[model samples]
Structures are given as structure tokens and as C-alpha cells.
Target: MYRTSAMKQYQTVNIQAQTSGASPHRLIQMLMEGGLSRLAQARGAMERGQIALKGELIGKAIGIVGGLRDGLDLEKGGELATNLDGLYEYMVNRLMQANLKNDAAALDEVSDLLRTVKSGWDGISQ
Candidate 1:
């Protein structure tokens, strides 16, 4: 219990630091990183047979994807935004499947997709 609290506090502080003075592109990158990190954790939890923790982590990943989707500026991003929304929806569905079935492959698939997107995003100079 003490360790969990300390970890949460550490994460909270880390997040606050990351967000402070961040540009829009940087914020999106952070969200992608956050989702990827959660998915990795969910995979580890699944390997450990920690069902509840796996679900929690998967849920957090889904929320991060949803946030990314929601943050898209359709007017500015145009077709790319639309495509990303579809991809995010697919990712969320796969995450739900992973949670329900303890399917590590599904998690891996989503993680790969997110990494690909993140890589592309990283290439853009902002």
C-alpha cells in the first residue's frame, strides 16, 4: 500500500512536469507515450495473472487513445484527422478485447500501431 501511494505520487509529479510548458505537439506526444506505457504495463500484469490490474491499465490506455482522438482538430487536420479517429477507434476496440480475453497479442498489436503513429508524429518538427 505504501509503495503504491509513493508510485502514484511519483507518477503525478512526473506528469505535471511533463505537461508544464508543453506545446500542443509535445502534449500529443506525451499522450502517445502514456498510452504505450499503460499498454506495456497491462501486458506485464497479464503475464503475472493480475487480472484486475491488467484491466485497469488497459482501460487507462483506451482512455488515452480516446483523448488523442478527441483532441484532433478536424478542420485543420482534415483527412489525416479522420483517419486517425478511425485508427484510434480500432485501437480502443482491440484494447477492450485484450482486457476481456487476456490477449497479449491484441495488446501487442495496438502497441505497435501506437508506436508507428508516435514515430510519425515524432518526425514532424514542432
Candidate 2:
């Protein structure tokens, strides 16, 4: 179904609720989930030739990736943090190209990278 106003409103409320109760680890998980979702949506929009929507979704995905990068603890996380920062930057760059070129393959590549990162994150004992 098409996104209705109510759907958007509900999503906002739901995210607020999740964030309020979530721990830092859970929040990271949510960000990964959101990034993946946006990439998929953006890809669909590209396939459908919805250029504007694709741009909007890709922008949101980039922001989410940037947020994740910003949240890294460089001092405490050390080399892992540095590596992740590089990966996030690469993802953001690829997303920009995907948006400009409407390349679904680039979107898929980013999505795969996110999934790999998310899997590593999910393995941590929380």
C-alpha cells in the first residue's frame, strides 16, 4: 500500500517509543535496520523511476550512516572505530553516486556492507 499520512505519523511515534526505551546497542541496531530499509526503498523507487522519492530516501540513508559514524568512540574503539568510520564514509560516497546515477547495483553493494556490519554487531553479547 502507498504510504498514508497516518502511516508516517505512526512510524514517527513508534520510533520515538523505541528510542526512549532502547539501550545504546539497541539504538545502533535500529539505525542499521533503518539504513537497510531506506536502501531497499530507494532501490525500489529507482526501479519505478520515482527520482524524487529515490533521492529523498538515499539522503535519509546517508544521514543514518553518518550518524552511525559520528557515534563511534574513536578513542575507546581504536582501530575498529577507525575501520568502521572508513566504511561508513565509503557507503555514503557510494550512496551519493547511486542517487545521481540511479544505480541499483551500488545500492545493493551498500546494503550488503551494512548487513555484514550489522551481523558483527548482532553477535555481541548485550
Candidate 3:
């Protein structure tokens, strides 16, 4: 139980650091990271036959993607925001499929896509 407690503490601290005074870009990056982490967890759960855990993780991923889509500012963002909105939708659909079919490939695809988006977002420092 010591390890679990330590992990919980670490997560709490990490979340505090991520949210405290975070910019909008930083928040989006965090969301992408969260979704990627969930996708990874879901894939592992699928491999281990943990159907409920897999479903939960995939659901969390879908929610994160949806949040990212909804957070886009179409007016100020222009074409880029529109493209991202479409991409986020695709990611959510793929995540749903991954959850239903236990498809690791689908999970990997979404993970890769999120990583690419995060990489681009990370490059915008300020």
C-alpha cells in the first residue's frame, strides 16, 4: 500500500503543477497527454482481459478528446481549429472502436496522432 499511496501523492502534486497558472496551450497539452496515457492503459487492460478497466480508460480518453474538440476557438483559430476539431472527432471514433473491439492497433493509431499533435503544441512556447 505504500507504493499506491506514494503514487497517489505524486499524481496529486503533478496535477497541481499542471493546473496552477497553466496557459490554454499548456492545458491542451495536458489533455493530450492524459488521453495518450489512458489509451496506453486501455491497451494494457485489453491484453489482460480486464474488460471493465479497458472500457473505463477508453471512456476517459473519449472525454478528453471531446474536451479538446470543444475547447477550440473556431473564430480566432480559423482553419487550424477546424482541422483539429475534425481530428479530435476521428480520435474519439477510433477510441470507441478500440473499446468495442479491443483493437490495440486502433489505440496505437490514436496515441500516435495525439503525440504528433502534442509535439506541435509543445513547440509553441508562449
Candidate with best TM-score? 2
What are the runs in model 2 whose C-alpha is more than 4 Å off?
A: 1-20
Superposed by TM-score, candidate 1 places the C-alpha of residue 110 at a distance from the truth, in angstroms, of: 0.2
The lDDT per prediction is: 0.83, 0.84, 0.80
Error of 1 at 38 (Å): 0.3
Q: Give per-residue CA lDDT, model 3, range 1-126, as digits (tens).
A: 323432443344347657697766666777778878988999999999999999988887877777677678999999999999899889888888888888999999999999999999989978
lDDT of 2 by residue, 41-110 (tens): 9999999999999998988888778778777899999999999999998998998899988899999999
- How good is model 3 by TM-score? 0.84
The candidate with the higher TM-score, 1 or 2, is 2
Off by over 4 Å in 1: 1-19
The number of the candidate with the highest lDDT is 2
| Pairs that collide, model 1 | none
* TM-scores for candidates 1 onward, in order: 0.85, 0.86, 0.84
- Poorest lDDT segment (10 consecutive residues) of candidate 1: 1-10
lDDT: which is higher, 2 or 3? 2
Better of 1 and 3 by lDDT: 1
